[model samples]
Target: MMSGPAQKYVYTKLDQIKEGTVVNLYGVVKFFKVPYRSKGTDYCSTVTIMDQSNAKLTCTFFSGNQDTLPKIYSIGDIVRFHRIKITQFNSEFLGISSNGFSALVFEGTAGAPALPRTSSKTYSFTEEDHKIVESLRIWQMGQQTFSNLRLKLSDIKPEQYFNLICHLVGKAVLDKACYLLKVWDGSKCALPAWKVCVEEEALEGDADFLSLHQHLTVDVLVYDNHVEAAKSLKVGSYIVIQNLHAKLHNTCNENQAENSYLEFHLHGGTLYGRGITILPENDIDVQELQKVLTTVNLNEEPICSEDLTSHNRLSQKSPPFNALERCQQLSVTVLPTRQEWLTTPLSTVVKMKPPQKYRVRVRLRIFQPQHLYQSVKLHCTKCSSLQAVPDEERLDNILQGNYTNCPDTDAQNAYWYQSVKWKRNQENRTVTIHFMKKHDMLQIPQESLIMVEGGTFKEFCKLSRKFNSIIPVTCNQANLELDLSAPFLVQGNIWHYGCRNCSSLKSIEALSSLTLEGSWNATEIAKALGIKPLTYVFVMNLTLEDETGSLNAYLWRRAAEQFFQISASEIFMVNNLQEQLNVIMTTLCPPGKSIGEYPWMDCCIKSYHSCDGREEQNLYEIFDTLIS
Candidate 1:
């Protein structure tokens, strides 16, 4: 018979019971068998029971005084065992013998509370209970314990007994009979988290497997019967796992040298006594762990595989070479004439192999030459040391148009240059010309008759020839004649100046419609238009169409402000600016009109020579007062 207090029978939950501990627990009998002789030595009987926590425990009793326990405890009867020896068999269970001082009492009388038998009862905890659970000391990675210890992914060592917490960032990849979960936690190394390989049976029978599939809140992929308690969990649910075996896996790549990471398994070893326990998210330990995780900066963590590979590549030693030598090794092609190269579209330039050179006649028309040049210190590429160059002397030479006297030595190299942006082919183009041994600056005012040789490297196009590579060549602007007698009507979608050639005209009056392409943020719009910082500008692309042809026009801030009757700053403040711009475009260019008919508006056509020295034209329609 039970005495002392009724609560004394509430020992630790079956999952929390440690081996060698004398426990007094109350559990409802799930299964029971009459006493029978094992090897004809002593009578034995087996019974499985479950507590309010839903933890199952199997009780084995041997003959003597305890022989009547199996007969007294029937299925669905709540029984109390006092001082039973808690041991681990397939999992944690209890062992009792008639000779032992253990006692059993039935708690199914009218005085006891009626417990549910059809389903597992969830054990509720009070604040005091939560405090007690939190205060319990659990084994950590570096500790030696009777049971396996919990470890962080970084602390896991090869052939060690450990478990960890990780977020499942990828789908499980099945390899043969095991499912591998890719996990990661914000740690030092960029290596993938310990690979958690779960057996097929463990995954299929897990009740939480269905919940995990339905609501992917929990990042950990659990594989054991313990997951039955986590069926209510969802993705992002913080959990603590215990008792897993860790083994180191090598990539077997010679280049990867000694690189290795850990892999965790749930089965195959007695060291992991109870297989694995996936704690509920609300568990006190898991809540504490969640607090620790909140401080980790997962965004900056190096979890990208590509970044890891790149880091490995950079760690290796490499050689250095001169810029000219590097250029010589690339695939360089020199076209015969500028006309052929000019016909090559910008898209083609983007796809072509780098270090390509072209010989073309380019007119030099600097937009703001004063802002183009700046004094900058040069450095020796090999030693990474600054090279000494008198800035005043260099400026004097640049002004005098005698830029060829700069000295160049093995130890020191002087590279004084200016970046000039200018209008070419009615499009903006920029080039940086080094004033090394070239007097090219003198031709700036002359609309240079000299041949221009340049190269394209990476994203930079039309890189001017360095001082040492500049050569004098006799070339003239190709004579281009236009046939404008018969009016040249419409062609396929708006003709790109670089793609199609049109007859040069001073002005044209056309009935047209305008359609807004789109609007972008001020900063992004500025970047796309190559507008300098601090320059107040709002820009958008508009498609102007007529029965004859169409053109994609650039509407700068000044022109857009006049046409829209609002300041650029005010236009940016409109919440639905795109829709507003479309409305304006529709008013200017009414849709569904006859192919070539609309209210006639006079448009001034401007022409400029392209890189090939052939004229390209653009149309500008400004609302200016008509001169009487």
Candidate 2:
């Protein structure tokens, strides 16, 4: 001890200590390792100390008269060092030569009796010390200089020494004498360390430490001093790692290479020049990095199983509103009338004045009933293609809890079907509708008046289901009555026919109306109709007449069935033609009903001029009908 009263020792903080500078330091013993043989006969031991400023210095004690230094000093014991030589290795500033001439004095222990102490230093922690630790600023990865590279998992390279900050996901897995820690920073990785023996018994006994279940990717591997520091931490704790070794394993197989990931291992041996360092989650840099990580993860789409499970659990806790509630909440606003909607081009609707709501009413001709009625289909959960149910019935069953115990299948597999419908005169314009719910599906019917309540024009153009509602309206309330005297109505005798193509007939600028003067024969009407695609039902062609002239019109599957009071298949399958005709005549023009009293059939005339070499008269065809 070179400490006489005249030549007193000069004390210095670890940060200010310089190589070869002999100084005295007073601090708590942070950690210490048992003395071990170095080369031959020479024994060495290491101890770390942190001053009031939180600056750390590791001291290595070599063979000396005070060979029991490690056994005499304990963690958290306030101690004073005399004439310690400071040194630097691998850019790490530390103190060395805590042997010969350097004296260690344990403070407040000269006359005190021994007392019971916890096996782990964590139990000796005070709230004040915890607050101080939390307030300390952590060194950021970016702040690391060229000699000490700090890197993210994605930027890690093979055979490099780097520092990283990450979350401890699970308990460290013990492999032989080494510990494997699973860590993640959004990106996952593993960290392995050897020769770490701090708090081993306590860590092994902790239930949480033993049952760590989260699998994290290794971002960096820390060993020696750093691993010792980490072993005291619990799962889900954030930590700062220093001097980690990144190692890559070579594989010859391409598949193995594709499946391979980076592994971090802490170098315990002195070959790497120095060991690692660790900072607790309270470090300022760690907290700042954690904030940044939280912001980034908030923006990223969660693709992890944990995220999915959380989302599913949240959704299960709060189910969506039922169909009745949705319908009751819908509100209506003033919209374009039926005639204006029909005449105004879709382009005009798109270019309407600002602040204009996107809802309209129009009379649409129903050419195919299957387009609207059969659009929605329910798929089975077990085998989507094996079974299907209609939208209406499926929704009813769902509401009635009939599907509560669905076997080996997910009930969410049932979904509404989607299809498109074309306007009567404007065949080029189409509207797509999805039967997402029973209310939406039931609200729309073939050839019915509808009031689109609310939506944006862009959404309307896309026919998004986000719209408020598309409710069926009565023809009288919609003011959709047709003017029979309009000259645009196609006029001709029932028997007379032209050879015009159906395409040309669709070009006529008119709203054609037809009145059934008398009962029609079912067999005759069925024979004149055409079969709709996908459905085997027959459509009916009827010559609707008024005093001026008779016009050709066709009834689609649903309308034809309604007019004939029976399904098309039933009418076609009848063995007696007279009986089928009788059924159709009574239904088409019921007893005691005049031509004017019967429902008026509104239609659009579609025709094509003959293009064949032979001269031919233009034929007019009514492709679709709207019954009012």
Candidate 3:
């Protein structure tokens, strides 16, 4: 980051940085923790940076005054750190402020101002340094969603962080270190948002408008160091709350968590870059947020929480502007309800804390299960699980191996199913064929479900040709049992598979409570019997790229079905449907061609922590999108 003699003096590249040496370096801000009052006297800020080499460095800067710290407003902003020591910490290299360390920041928008945002009026600025910043700005435009972190309230999810640009309508002092800031961003949160009551109250400009539209307002609890910042914010002024924590209220009673809901908590510390940063008049996002506010329905009737059912809470959200038109252009899937949030960058999408949704635009890079046939899988709804579609040949071997077990009972007289002896395969006891006689067809109806105790897979196939479905089972101590080795249910060449560790077997008697139709409803029957019916579903990892970045998302389950306009079952059962899927895939990412050949899709995507809370499990998921 310093101007120097051509070819004689070059600023240190982040990749070429050496430990123990102090050097001036420039990098694009990948992430930054806002300057917060550290445990010590200094204000500390943590920043992660990268260069064209793709080498990233995590650096910490400390200053007696917060203003002197690097002014990083966005993710892709350029920064020049002068005189920082490169040291190894916890086995990873880190940049720490050294003697005489000074920082300068620049806008990352290409062709924008190259002037540095700094406290110092006088600093080295030359043609070479200007070119370096320009080069970084140009490169960052293609990296990803590095422009902004602001999010609408409607898209919030629990246990995540986001930046909110909103009008401050009301404020109330809570406890000594906490303040409740009631604000709205025109949009309404899908999940129930909170409103806190305090002894004292204050109101102003936007309060009356927000009071009428109480449902749109969200209670933001600003705590500790952030309390001071929120106190000065005037009602009706546009403001941005940085690193706001959208979390479940921790005070809810464990046994009775009915009161537990999502609350915006601006926790005391600035460790993860928390706190309010800019005003409405200064930032660009607030300008658009202002436009959304004007669109709020002022004449709308206000309803209390008790009056509004959960389904009607967020009756509607930002209406998709030209969403139909955009979908028709190239999007494979579109949100059920048209959405207003425009397409976000993939890089920005990845940085988002989970449990929320966003609109994004991307082109298919590649799809997993390179052999498309392998993409079809059987998914269990009860306990989320995916397994390969059961192979008939393998299942045949399992049924033949277990046919010797005497699994039938004579007590079938009391139940809807009646037991009968098979003519062959009499290993020890007679093979009992428990026939569900409710079907109106012949004695052994094709629409019925048959449970057998002793029969080979071949014999079951012979019976299934006449009957539509058959389950091979055993009786143990008056209890019906199913070992997971073979298919739980077999219909011709089709086999239904379940989970390895999550499934527990229940008896056919479980279905006795439900009324039967002419044909068995497999999903309803599976639910009744505690047998997870496996439905063929598409589960494939896809690489979606845009000018900013690439995101790898799972085109899975209902999302996949909607995207293809063909159910996984239809694709699995019909050859033409499978061929149709191939044509769609080929269109999204054609064979042996440049990326420019791929089609673009305007989509809705969600990013979040995985169920198990594993960091690696955090991923981007394609949702509310369809391939047309």
Candidate 4:
């Protein structure tokens, strides 16, 4: 340690930064812009750094070459710079990289390897630098600044260029100039995301999976240079889309302008370091994303377990929402945000413009779907359709079809299925079984789904036990027509239905040429049958009141589940869970007490445009809050 005027310490901390002086500093990057091509034929990067003091310093660096600009991997990385000139700008100190500047970056996770992710090979890293980095990492681990840097899909607004950490679910080539990468972060966007139209065959991922996640998926159009890189990304790859431009979609292609709906684009060029970086499977960020995906089952088929054991296990693996503690609270405090100035009063939020996020402290006045069971509804992400769960009597009626008589047995695919004849009302009807090639005399329900044609409701109950799934179909002219009244497929004694408005039923012959990419995949089966499966979600409205005002906002999507700390689909399977929910609700809004006596919560509410044609209205939604 070189102290006592022999160069006392090697690096300057953020608090020691002064104006009109050239100094070397080591700090944690709170925020940064990907290196972008500037007007002067140089690449520039804007960054905000802080030390243990939490004093932020704004820095700008320009380089004739893109490689010289800081290659900041993320928002929380530690950076060391040599020879930066600091000057006062607009009553604040600004640092600009002067001549003979050198930079090195390191991961900000404490106890991790002290490795530099820099473009320069000749930069020096002494024992002192290592000590500073490890210390900074330890400091950063305790700060909420890292989480603040991550913007959720629910929080994104139009015309903002931001970085997104998400997983790819689907991809398609729009043309030679453009490619589409459909991704999600397990949160629903505020507005309806723009959908790109193309032949389903052109898609590189499961069509059913894409349709199932339409509510969560955002289509990012990669253009020019970025399209090639996007094409190489496989479905399910975890990636960081740096400097992703979010704008409204319109025929005029006006950049940074609002339109009817929003879309994301990676515009052509290396500007803004606008490219995708694939993260390893074992990456911490990827693991976080996977946890969200697993809980929601958006990437795969929903479990049909009879008990809540699976969902209970899921909760144990995740960060507990502490719903029990929250329900008992008499008062709730609003969580602090990095940009505290953005917090708006409820009275002001209603009058504000669309496409903005606000934080507010408010109390729960009341909530509805007063009949909690009614809140459990099936939603189609693909078509934005919401419907009630079909009753057993109604579903059974739909499954029972008119008796048909056909004498001919279509033994078309003897290689895959066996043809059976059923005598209905004294007439012989041909029932073609599409997946019983050479199994048991009576195939068990553990096998892949069996497609049956000209089958009835009574037939389903008998055959349901024979196979894992059963899809009843009818031949119309030359095309296969599935009865839209019933489920497109059924599995594990759980009835799953398709969205009537979204599904475009395909021919049974389509599966003749089908090749299974993986195991007995449910998503692929839905795609083969042109079925868009429905997702079960909880939806409710909460009337929140602050000192200023009260407004009606919905507790919807994943947030509702997060708030309850329970799965919507599994809530019904477990009797005690419903009692728990009732207890939580009653705690928030007591029956005997007046509205004034109700408890309060400091919530982060989002303001967005209503999709339903209340054109003059701006909608408010409660997001990211769990009671306990």
Candidate 5:
């Protein structure tokens, strides 16, 4: 006779349970519950039984009665419940509560043997979770471990989960718009605090596969001020999301919504891990894991189809400056280095041999009739240097327009750099010229057959119309031949300049150009010519001496006015004392082709005490007026 009724259910795993069979599984009771909205309100606690294989069976204790079960059926606590309804919700095993099966019996075993489990460490979620939350809109990237702590859910935003660890445990699936759950280590909390996403294939036993109740376990991420329907989690299905972040959501009146979260910024200091471990609780070395991950990423190869092709074209080009190295080595004459000023005292003049004179032919080209009418000649004498002319005497001559006269009573007195006679051809043309002797002309016979070549003959004629000779006047007596085909010699000095191989006198036969050889110094000039015992090579001194024998007076005023002003810088001539008294009348003379614009006048003014005297007289006049 078949038993009329079987009261005791035994030896059935929740995962292997078939329909029409009641299974009694003895395991630690894993509880979960919905959160209470208020202190006086209540929420249901759900319990679970998992066989040794980690497969689970779900059970729910409705509110109002489950408060007593917490004292005995706490999470991780082994227990047995009787009179449970054996039912299959979708394909998964679920136990329903009966009014008669309220108490936890001390002994009754079913699915797995009753066992104890350890509590897992948990961590609080942070804002970094929102950075890569795209999969769940608020899910963490993923981590290997967890800790239990009050997490901030509202901090999660959409599409931003990258680096965070999350822990979630709840019923895997829900039906009839209701389910039961309880946190493993913490108080029962609502699953609505998270957002849910689930794979349809994971839940196949549903009557209507896409139905909300058919969802096995809601997939979700936590967000907002409260848990959403999706975030309401379950037991036996925990999620550890990683890499989360936070950002502004919205605002409110007077009280900003941004300030709503009391503990939104929650980042747990990692414990139990070494060297920046994301899964510190696990025994795996983080360095090994990183290396494995990096290698896996590196081994991935790109795929290409058989017909793929890409092409690039190139052109030949040439470089610039290809011949630059060859151009720098061509012929070029280099001048001597410029002279540095000597620092010796003016009074300590060293008596030395005069600068030698290399005979240079100078052909003076006269522009006006007067210079051309007169015979062009340069007079040289073996003379001694007379004493310097007083400034008063020079000033009187300049004021009286006697610059053409010599101030010294002795007619033979002469000073270096002083031009005895100088005349200009026209404002547009230069009148007088001088230059060194040409070496080629020195070797020719006195009456040699001179062959005119190229345009040299015509050039020589133009130059010969202005000067008596091309060689220096000092070399006039030298036995030298003539080469009319030569280019005219040009000279630069204090008063005269121009092509010197021109016609200065009619009777003057045959002129040739000359070029000075050697430096403007004495020994070199003397050595260039085949002359012996060469006299002096004139050089103008810029420094002057005083009448009291001091070196700072107007001793070199003549040289300074000629050389310093002409060669060094522009020369300004003061012609009259009365006019000079009127603002020290200074005039900048145009550069004469001879010596160029020099600082001659400036040097003269500096050497003499005339400027000092005038300034003192002006001061004295002012004092007299003030005292009067």
Candidate 6:
């Protein structure tokens, strides 16, 4: 170590020497910045080094000492600069910058400094830094530290600064205290004291100048000579700010916090005109963040074992939200954003603007699993809805948890509709319109129609089981008991279209107001009406059957729109002989069997009592023609 009691040698510690001294030091590089001028004069790079005890020193180059300015040092790089000289810079103010000195650039092989690998552990504030901040409250004088604990800042009047960082962590967003910040490092929480006077430029693609939750690991830089350093703090970063003065008498205004005045103050550490260096951690990869992000499901539970569960729970399994198969897909972006609603209180519900409505349109592409494509409902006001804000604003508001309203209705019963898209078959998909609003149970229950447009053999079985199991139970409760005891039909009233034995049928005077229960099946309707079952086959059967077009080109094409209009009390199976014959003659007959069979075999036996083979064949053709 170079120790001197002479004119050229100042009385300072061996670690403080940057040039003209032979001192040995071991510390981590906290900040590294290369200095350059517009005239192409590249000066030496400077670094803030902290030793084993977390003590800091400013290492700089002497005037005209150009050899130390090369790429020998970087932030987060730990090095041992050996056999170097030490001297302070020439400046009007002596104490802080006076310790500035530099060293020779280390070569790769010869005279290269020994670099150390950094670990995951973070350094905590020294006892002295904490004491200085706490001491500010008791003293009227302002004092700051530029060294590890050197008082580089002062001028604070008594009790001007917040004693502990905890006071600001979850407080309501305040306007006063220019440097107010609530920062966390995944484990510990800290308030990053900021100087409100400085303006911060936004992150690369964001608009919020002071937003800091995206980057994850960052340092808050403070510099005595420059303003740029103080304005560069980012989101998701961890930083420790030291050696800057705390204003002694600053008080947030009693009315508006942003208008308060600082009685005592310190130069922002970020303004020291220094560049902050960040060392990369092991878990900084994208995969690591993926593990932390989670998906949430919000829908009703299954009404019955057979009924389709409220909605498909499949998430697109790509990078973000992927699913197993291709389905009818649409993206919905709603507001206060689901995240914002969660953070705001119920009473503060007035802050939210009225719900906005959106339209959803879906069409059947493939035809396998039968599905419905049109539905509408209101959306829920909750944590997820608030998350729909722009990416930048989403960062600060994600965890606020103010979800307290229904996002679907207005005071006078006006409803805002939300859209839902789901897969039914590769061919036909379902679309539902929904919104979050106050429901009127007195007007209508949630019983909507379940129409299957196109379905496969497997899907048909599933739908059949679901329809037979659940729908009848709900219908039996809604009807059945009203008409058995009373009959009101006495004449040619149009209301006589319903069950003659039930009085409820008399109440349905118009089709628009009637809430009748009904079931539909392509196969069943085809058999009863003497049409081909070609429409019952969807995309899946088209591949297997390789079938094309209709059995009868004119009639089969129009069968889907034709209704089989069923009564609520009717059973699923055919009970009468005419209905039974319709199934056997039209639906059960093989595709080409009709042309070869005796035409009137069924009717001739009933009418003529007996017939010759030729007459029977002719009569069979006529019977087949009528039902087929």
Q: Which candidate achieves the best lDDT against the true structure?
A: 3
User: On residues 210-311, what C-alpha lDDT tens digit does candidate 1 reach at each position?
Assistant: 333222212233333323323433434443344454434344456553455443544311221223223345444455566765676645542367644643
Query: Which residue pairs collide in model 4, if any?
Result: 36-272, 322-628, 326-628, 334-602
Sorted on lDDT, best first, the list reads 3, 4, 2, 1, 5, 6
**Model 4 TM-score?**
0.41
Against the correct fold, how does model 3 do in TM-score?
0.43
User: Which ten-residue region of model 6 has the weakest summed lDDT?
Assistant: 537-546
RMSD to truth, every model = 35.7, 38.5, 25.7, 26.4, 48.7, 37.6
Off by over 4 Å in 1: 1-148, 167-176, 185-234, 237-243, 253-259, 267-271, 302-306, 310-628
lDDT per residue for candidate 6 within 383-424, as digits (tens), equals 111111112123113211111121212212112212233355
Give Cα distance to truth, residue 84, candidate 5, Å: 1.9
Model 4 lDDT tens row, 94-195:
999887887887877788777676666566666777899999998888888865345778888865667899999999887776788999998877655666
List, residue by residue over 412-457, the lDDT tens digit for candidate 3.
Answer: 5435666677555454546667776553222436446777775665
- Residue 558, candidate 3: Cα error in Å is 38
Highest TM-score against the true fold, candidate: 3
Each model's lDDT comes to 0.34, 0.37, 0.69, 0.69, 0.26, 0.24
Name the lDDT of candidate 4. 0.69
TM-score of each: 0.26, 0.27, 0.43, 0.41, 0.18, 0.21
Runs in model 5 with CA error above 4 Å?
1-12, 28-31, 35-43, 63-79, 99-628
Error of 6 at 556 (Å): 99
Greater-TM-score candidate between 1 and 5? 1
RMSD of 2: 38.5
Q: How many pairs in model 6 have backbone atoms within 3 A of each other, for residues 3 or more apart or on separate chains, i.e. clashes?
A: 101
Instruction: Report residue 518 deviation for candidate 1 (angstroms).
Output: 94
